[model samples]
Target chain A: MIKTFTRNDLIRYIYQETTKEENTEIENALIFDEALCDELGDLQLTVNGLGRIERSPSKGSIDKILSYSKYYNMNAVN
Target chain B: MRKYSVSDSQLISLYKNGNEGAFADLVNRHKNKIFTTVYMIVKDQYLAEDLLQETYIKVVNTIKSGRYNEEGKFLPWVTRIAHNLAIDHFRKAKRYPTIVMEDGSNVFNTLEFSEDSIESQKIKEDTHALLRDLIKELPDSQREVLMMRHYMQMSFQEIAEATDVSINTALGRMRYALINLRKKMDKLNIAYDKNLYQK
Candidate 1:
């Protein structure tokens, strides 16, 4: 019997939180279910869009982190 | 020889053994996501930078003191630290209301768009910026679930435990967050063009 996946199930599938069996089931369902496919597509797009908006810290922030690590190491060694 | 990406565990082990370069690699690998996580909560680049520094300092102290037991889960562990620090700062300063402008639009909406940019790139940036603002407009519970799952890459189970909610509740918030974001995007007439998102 085919499984009826909920939106939460699809969310887990997108995030790769589903088990192997569930993954197989969802992939099969996607083949025959247009609405399911569309829902998954919309969710995936929004997640991907959120990922693309990332901003990096300044170089100075990174430098300070590295320097702090080095300083701690030096203090520990002495 | 083909270049192989080093695992976070390997980098952590190296850093623990006095390899600063490995620590630098780890930071460079995960900095953007970590920074973005804090920036989303704090909403100020400079303050996020400060918190990022503090987060790493805590990370360094934990690792150096031989207390960093989160072996394989480096990114999420670091992200939790950043998230907590940002939340502490947010609580102490009460800065939540400042993100809303007098016109009801978010401060992020005021970011300048370049007139001469390529159309697709412009749209992508505009959409992303607007989406970021929309995220801020979400209910705090929904926003927390979205950030914990989407940005911090925490599992819904982990998010449930962290937020003191049921797993189903976490999943429901994520679902609503996505549905609401889609509805808002459509209302604003933003095209959900997959072609525009291609690298």
Candidate 2:
């Protein structure tokens, strides 16, 4: 059986927070552990899928946001 | 025409200096994230839009009044505003979703968008719709963690701080969420990775 790493350890690995030597350990663990490796892959996919969602702000919306600035300043001076 | 590095601090500085357009530029740049962030909190698109607007308005108001201080990070500043407004809305309404159970098991999981054939984009739309349904099956905590981490681009540390959980706890939730999502995909025969799973 593959050695079980703590969830915190996995998270540390996910965020590149792992030290160089520890990073190698995680990689080696995955190579030896099927379930753990699959779990890591799943997390990778969820993050990738979410990252794929790009922001497409509507046109003219920025104008509205800017207008608020004008209104704020106007109110402040009054 | 000088691009000031596009950092939040630069944008906030520009906006505070009475550059109205700068405020708009910043909002436009981050509006989607703002919208998504608010949407995940409220789970209502229309209301989320309203709160999203309120967040920007408050930012404008704060900056114009010179009440906006240079903080740890400008992006987090606006996000904090958005987060507060969302929490306030929920408190006043006293309404939370049913699916978001105590244990954080709710449906708001996978969000995928597949491509169609060489014809029209109809199939792609269908894929998006299907993905939306799948996400609704995710537990509230999982969905929230997944969306905040993925969509809002918040780190686990940020999520922990924002959601009032320890980093380890947040990580555990996410890990379980992914495992649950994998099971859901399997049940539906969604074939998230047909090639890899086949072997």
Candidate 3:
């Protein structure tokens, strides 16, 4: 039986969020569904697009964290 | 001199046994994701930094109190703390409004970009900065899913459990996040490499 996939299903497939059985099911469904294939392609592009957006905490933040840990260490030892 | 290649679980155990330096190592290791996760949710750099410190303090307390026992999963465990603290801040501030705007404006103008000589470099950097801006404009729930899935590297099931939502709900949020990003990209006339998926 052919299965109808939702956008959520496409997301799970694109991100590898599905289980093995679900993956097999989605892969099997993708073979005959041109539209699903296209949607997957588009969503994959969006997913890859997200890689461009990167963020890191400030160095001051890291120092603050380490300083806090240092205080905790002093207290725990005493 | 402790080796720098220690695993999180091992470092955690060392901290539990009173080696506080190990705790610092653990915090340093996961600092980027934890801070980014908190910052994305709180949307204030200063407040996120405060919460980031508080989150580690709480983790230290939790481990000292003999509460943390799950081994080899330190990243997810700490992320759960970070997410909870961010949510608690949102609740206390009463600022988590479910406002979804159809038009992407105002928020996109805040990010500063540097000038690049190479055209490809310019496009790459601009696309990155633009996507970061658009992400801040996503609805609160969608943004959370995107951060957890893409940044924190949580599975759908793990995200659902951490956020206390259903797997289908988590999946739906991620789908909408991508779709919304695509729409914004088109609306803003930002041209990403069409063959991005192929590479």
Candidate 4:
């Protein structure tokens, strides 16, 4: 019997939050369900897009953080 | 020696033992994720930088004082600190409502895409910038869930606990966040094709 999954299940599946049994079942369902596959594809694309949008902090900010760490260390030693 | 082969827990241990280089490595390894998480919340690069620095200072203090007990979870712990600091900044300044500027321009517009001269690279960067703006447009609950799950790498259950909601509700918010993002992307005619973003 093919078990139907909800959008929430798909979300969990894509995030790898689903259990091992659920993973096998979802993989099986994806092979037979075009709509489910499409939904997963769209969700996966959106997640991937989110992953690509990282911004780095300024070098000066990082330097300040590092210096602060050293300063704290020096103070601790004193 | 391969840089970054050192795990976060290992780095934390080394830093606790007075190795400043280990601490620097830890900072460098997770700085982008922490910065982006704070940036998404505060929506200002400068504020994000300040929060990032503050977050690290807190990390140093916590680790140095031996109060940092979240072993093997450095990124998420620092991210939580950055997230809280950003939220606190808005709360203290009463600037929550001003997240969307009056002039309708975002701080991301000022960022220079100087490294990539290629047209495709530029298009990818532009798309990413636009997506960031759309993320800002999302409802606060949805955006919060997205930030926690995507940027902070928190599991849905953790997000639920952090936000004081059920796990299902957290998952639902994430689903709506992605669906709404897709709708906005379609409305703006941004292509979802992976090939288009390839260099």
Indicate which candidate wins on TM-score.
Answer: 4
Residue range B1-199, candidate 3, lDDT tens digits: 1245787888878987878788777877777677767766776666777888788777776787788876537776778789889889889878783433323322322223333345654455556656767888999799889998886778899889978999999999998988898899889887776322222
Instruction: Show where candidate 1 strays beyond 4 Å.
Output: A73-78, B1-4, B94-97, B100-122, B194-196
Best DockQ goes to which candidate?
4
lDDT of 2 at B64: 69
iRMSD for every model: 4.1, 5.5, 4.9, 3.4
Ranking by TM-score: 4, 1, 3, 2
DockQ of all candidate complexes: 0.53, 0.34, 0.40, 0.56
- The lowest-lDDT stretch of 10 consecutive residues in candidate 4 chain B is B102-111
Candidate 4 lDDT tens digits, A1-78: 899998899999988899999999999999999999999998998888776677877778989999999999575542
Off by over 4 Å in 3: A1-4, A76-78, B1-7, B17-25, B93-125, B152-154, B158-165, B194-199
Q: What TM-score does chain B of candidate 1 reach?
A: 0.84
Q: Residue B100 in candidate 4 has what lDDT?
A: 40
Ranked by DockQ from best down, the candidates are: 4, 1, 3, 2
What TM-scores result for chain A when each predicted structure is judged separately against the true chain A? 0.89, 0.62, 0.77, 0.89
Q: List the residue pairs that clash in candidate 1.
A: none
Clashing pairs in 2: B106-B138, B106-B139, B106-B140, B107-B136, B107-B137, B107-B138, B108-B135, B108-B138, B109-B135
Better DockQ candidate (1, 2): 1
Superior by TM-score: candidate 2 or candidate 4: 4
Alpha-carbon shift of residue A17 in model 1 (angstroms): 0.3
Model 4: share of true interface contacts reproduced:
0.70
